[model samples]
Target: MTRATFEIEITPNETPLLPGVGRFDFQKVWEGDMQGRSVGLMLSAGDPASGTAGYVCMEVFEGTVDGKLGTLAFQQLGTMDGGNQGLRYIIVPGSGTGELEGAIGVLNLTVDEGTGEHSILLEMSSDH
Candidate 1:
């Protein structure tokens, strides 16, 4: 399998859910921005690697999922790449289901033939 590598740096804006949560490191997938799109993002996240403590990382974004703006739809694809600890998860676009709730966590991604230097931000939001 083709392996994509990434150097991910996350700046925590809030730690209401995690008290000791600070800057965490992740190796993610580089899925490149889609053509003719306003923004772009890559999937990333993982479990506590020695010091970091959290759940599996999972997300789908384009530029920004939330903002000083209004409701925006982040189309989450079921397939993506990259992460350590060997776990799998996804976020789809819709409501009334069990996954698209208020619950939030990290998103780890990996892609084929990607490397560090590629980056994106994963912001939080509600399904409604």
Candidate 2:
């Protein structure tokens, strides 16, 4: 397995879908060795003060993974249980296109505490 790391920026727009429910549209941009953009939609239930909430999202990324040109579909499931948090993001099965075809992996994200800079750590099977 190999890992690709890159910086990420997310712009989110939220709209109320129902009581205590919201729909979010995200525009994501990637930089620093991985250049690309992604569009995602998320459904979130509950507010921050609720202490417990969950969100599910689907994002389609059109970009390069470790310099390999292609596209990937990502699925994210996240939840906040009381004061704890659990989140997972993975590449959808068979969702890789072009040179990324046959690629399989899970995506890990991290944020710098001081800079608030986001990064992605993608671990995938070689296909290029």
Evaluated with lDDT, which candidate comes out highest? 2
Clashing residue pairs found in predicted model 2? none
- Residue by residue across 1-128, what tens digits does model 2's lDDT show? 33444444444555556786777777777775557888888888866677788999999989887788899899999888778988899889899998889888888887788987777777788455
TM-score of each: 0.30, 0.82
After superposition, the stretches of candidate 1 with alpha carbons farther than 4 Å from their true spots are 1-9, 18-53, 56-60, 63-84, 93-108, 111-114, 117-128
Q: Which lDDT tens digits does candidate 1 get at residues 20-92?
A: 4333223233333311122223333333344322333333333213222222223333322334234343334
User: Candidate 2 — which residues are off by over 4 angstroms?
Assistant: 1-18, 126-128
Score each candidate by Cα lDDT. Answer: 0.33, 0.78
Q: In model 2, state the lDDT of residue 124.
A: 81
lDDT of 1 at 24: 27
TM-score of 1: 0.30
